[model samples]
Target: MAVAVNAAVTLPSSKTSSSPSIRFSSIAPERIAFSKGVGYLKNGLVTGGKAASIRAQVATETPTKVVKESKKDDEGVVVNKFKPKNPYIGTCLLNTKITADDAPGETWHMVFSTEGEVPYREGQSIGVIADGIDKNGKPHKLRLYSIASSALGDFGNSKTVSLCVKRLVYTNEQGEIVKGVCSNFLCDLKPGAGVQITGPVGKEMLMPKDPNATIVMLATGTGIAPFRSFLWKMFFEKHDDYKFNGLAWLFLGVPTSSSLLYKEEFDKMKEKAPENFRVDYAVSREQTNENGEKMYIQTRMAQYAEELWELLKKDNTYVYMCGLKGMEKGIDDIMVSLAARDGIDWLEYKRQLKKSEQWNVEVY
Candidate 1:
């Protein structure tokens, strides 16, 4: 059962306008639907206050047990075995830093020994339960991360799984430093450490099966996790079941050159299949655009939005975007301008893309 969380938020009335804005705090982060322009409900309704006063109650408690019947996707539904309440205890095999020593943030490549039949696909995620108690003296909840390795595992032949986790640390409003519980716990694990893992969850980021489909992957920060899995499945692995000869363009953004993750692996793949695989980087701190502004993923996309608009017209072009939710608008703006140049309504075009299951997004 979820505990009720009732928050009395004050919306300050403007001197000219009749209503004020709604400020929401003390709500569960998982329940809040934050976006680029406006906040929305889980069901896709905008939460913008149309009235002077609004009363909202958020269910802040996490379900201790989750046994969903199935998770839906374009590839049909998959019934996952592992879940939060009944999790699998797996052994940590390796914990290595993927980022350079001079990087600003700490990102790691963690591998865990699969106990037995813990099966997962290319884009699914596993839930990790930290080994500690929260303020309520209860066990810490599970945190989900996209699996960074192929279903066949690291060497292309094992039952193990991997993750790309960044240590989260930030200064709070009261001038206090806080660290994320599960991230720090995973980052600090040793070779023999025991971790409670659960759920091969999430279906939105799943890959299409067409071998000739053009894949446009846009990612930033640790959002590169799932794409890493897809790359491995396409170029590195020897799975004859899925042969990919299509064009895969990856646009990744990072703060520094040292922040590039799996840099060697991507280089090797590009060398092996130069014509089929392409990877572009937007190192913000190290490079600037023609406009003298710091180059981000959006800027990199704008450089070729016209070409991308052409590709979007193809029925087989699949665009997968996973990163900070804030980038949605910038990317949208770029596409809007490019679409307008050809007298195409980008809003309706995007809708058709979604209806065709060509546009996939899994942002945080």
Candidate 2:
């Protein structure tokens, strides 16, 4: 991440350095008029008399309240309402395994009773602090999990928040079994069990307000969390303020068909809105793509590369990716050649999409 410094400075002309002169066409003429000695600069040096005049002009012209007002209009994106030092104690309402018993690992769908105390939007995450102390003699650190339910929640009420968690259990180099403290705690949770929770953090994966916009979701494993929330809002629920009339296409990758999460719910959604929803599964072990290659998300996506590229070219299309960070590289590889077909630079195009908030990513 790059930290932006807010300090303002006037650089000397290109004659002072080996670099060529660069023009900043976006800067307003009046703002840089100081270079002509009308304000602060006098022969590349700040003049006290002119500096005060420029400061007065800036103070009167700049919109000091723009940032504050923009935040106020931001559709209520909630953040850390509960902190680690003082976390919210909520009760688990339900904890049921969603994955098949014979699947590679255990994945559970748990809903916590917030009782309207902990408000959250879709695509946000909650932090869970496990009950026990760690080897360092300190309390276990909280683990963040993506919220699986919409703002209306799993019960179609605002009192609950849900999560999709995969239990982490593995053998260490010493041949000892190790389990993830927070994940195991969440997975084994029973109804009425108290859970220490914090945060409804993150804004990157928030759904766009454009109700008719096309949504392209790419997920792997439990990365399906946020997308499930989005799909529920788009298909299963009805809102007086919002209606999704456009397309939502999902590509989910998993090791086996049995590991597919929320299969029944997604199937029902597709049945209800057949024209508006489409789903593709990439089961690496059971499915193969064209040319007999193991079916992965990117490979399945490659089948519709042309159609996807066209949709991506539209202003109302949004692509969201969440899962393992390596999935990004696979997507980039798929898009590179397709973008080149139209003489476009894929990286630069993707950057513009990000700048416009059209391409959203939340991968670990």
Candidate 3:
């Protein structure tokens, strides 16, 4: 049995770093502007000076008051009352195009901005509304995508929210080059395209706030986006604090090495938390499988079941699953097998996960 000698080394971000006041602000207002103007269209409701300017314009056009009054029924019974919430209502843009991949398949990375802040826990997703009708005269469709950057990276002082997207290719009833409305429109977008989007939903898949909690991230394909957001939230913004004592592990599965997103950033994260962070690459087409078939994270989990189980057994450990739709079952089954080998009941293991909120899966 070979026990890996991985010594922990605390990076500069750990000391007084968890506090934003301590960590040297990475994204300045200027950088935020550049990201909003140049990068993804960003979310539409993020609050900041940039968004405030837009809201001021809207207020001038629409004079609305926050009225607080109780509605009375037949006997003067208070039925409903209007209570003011945040006062700031987010505005959505319709069909705003930002960036596109002009390949055979029309994939995209669009952005939008908002008048109010749309704060989110890392790994949360949002809903998108497509434009126009399909070839079959159906209304535009809706899809969900995870936020690739942190709220701190894009909101408050920042002006944009970024998203990683893939165009859906499907044949409509007309048998023409019918494709997904929103995705195709996004794919054809130039720099100034715009669209409507709402929300930062999903409570099940969220990063633990405790800096000491370990994060085990597993994803395939574009599923890497939310993990990237989590990585940056844990490593980049909080780097100087030396406060995040948690171990961050990333198991990324892709078709090929070339298709691996954020390779450079992953290298940087490893350099920052050499012992505290570990990344496993599962390239199905590029690497030969030990079982003589295409490799995946499921197979990798099986190969290192004991170690994976040990990592899961640690205190304050969190598991996040993303990417392909079927991975949750495969990973869960592997964990169950490992639990059975350790004389732990599968049902108890699940209860433990629920109690600790250790197991978090987001598949689409």
Candidate 4:
């Protein structure tokens, strides 16, 4: 059990930190220039200036209109008219590449200026539709991504939303080279490009109303998005009505140091409030576990398994995990082992956490 502590700290940009050597030199240059937000694109693909601001809606649907796979919850959940059939048009504010010049993957910090009409809470996700007509002459479908900004918006003005996106590269089964259609579309977005957005979707990852509840977060790669929102609400933004008095411990995993998105901001918060914030990194390629295996978040968790178990037993603690679903078993394996130390059945123990609404997971 720990009480809140306060301190001041600073954050350093990614450019000033150590990063991995990028492996894809050939396909990278094209993506690099389009990645910097609010910066000049030497190729003239983008207009150089401040991106348009948020606060006006375009494209509304009628009440009788129906959208496929509606995002509303069962209890007549609050939802906006922006559905798959009709979506709000958002202006591209910025697209800044945050990874090193040689990192293995491409990660971008993107900001979308939205009309103030999209009401949302922390931990919700937004869907993006790439501009193009499919072979059937229909608009490309919307792809959902977690919202990386706080509920109050990037500036606490409810004017903008943000996302951390990674470019996907893979070889197609037909022996053709391919990149993610939607991901590259977003990565290539120019400052003035318009995007279709829908839904503030999902409440599973939302933060607890209790300002003093301990938050244990585990994320890998772009999964860090929602945690960014949680942290911003807890430390970065000032809510005169809400003051954080509990501890937040974040465990993050990545292929290399360069792949750590928002590292500067996380470090800044950890430094500013050492008593209230803590961060742990598991760089798979850069670090190794005691077994000499590549260190992932699971291995890092094992190192502190006992302590984590203690925290889980506390009713005030809530554990949230967001990332690729593959890591689920690795995490569960460790949890099972740790719970055994207390003479408890791990599966049953997990059930209790879920029943109490203390365990939240959003993975795919």
Best by TM-score: 2
Report the lDDT tens digits of candidate 3 across residue range 1-364: 1111111212224343111111113233222122211321112211345433433332324333332121111132211121122112223221222222222332234445543255555666766666666668976555677877665543332434557666678766888765566656655554345555556566666666557767888898778878877876665553343356778888888766655666666776677778777888887776756668777878766777777777665545678888888887777788776667656665556554654456777787
Q: For model 1, how does the per-residue alpha-carbon lDDT over 7-47 read when each residue is reduced to its tens digit?
A: 23233233431112223433433223211111211100112
**Comparison by lDDT, 1 against 4, better one:** 1
Lowest lDDT sum, 10 consecutive residues, model 2, at 36-45
lDDT of 3: 0.56
Candidate 2, residues 201-311: lDDT per residue as tens digits?
888888877787789999999999999889878876667888899999999999998799887777767787899999999999999986999998998999999889878
Clashes of each: 0, 0, 38, 3
Give lDDT for model 4.
Answer: 0.71
Tens-place lDDT per residue, model 4, 5-96, is 12121223556632212222222121111122221111100112311010001112222322222122434333554897888898886666
User: How would you order the candidates by TM-score, starting with the best?
Assistant: 2, 4, 1, 3
Q: Best-fitting candidate, measured by lDDT?
A: 2
Give all candidates' CA lDDT scores.
Answer: 0.72, 0.75, 0.56, 0.71
Off by over 4 Å in 4: 1-80
The reply for model 1, stretches above 4 Å from the true place, is: 1-78
What's the lDDT for residue 169 in model 3?
Answer: 81
- TM for every model, in the order presented, reads 0.78, 0.80, 0.67, 0.79
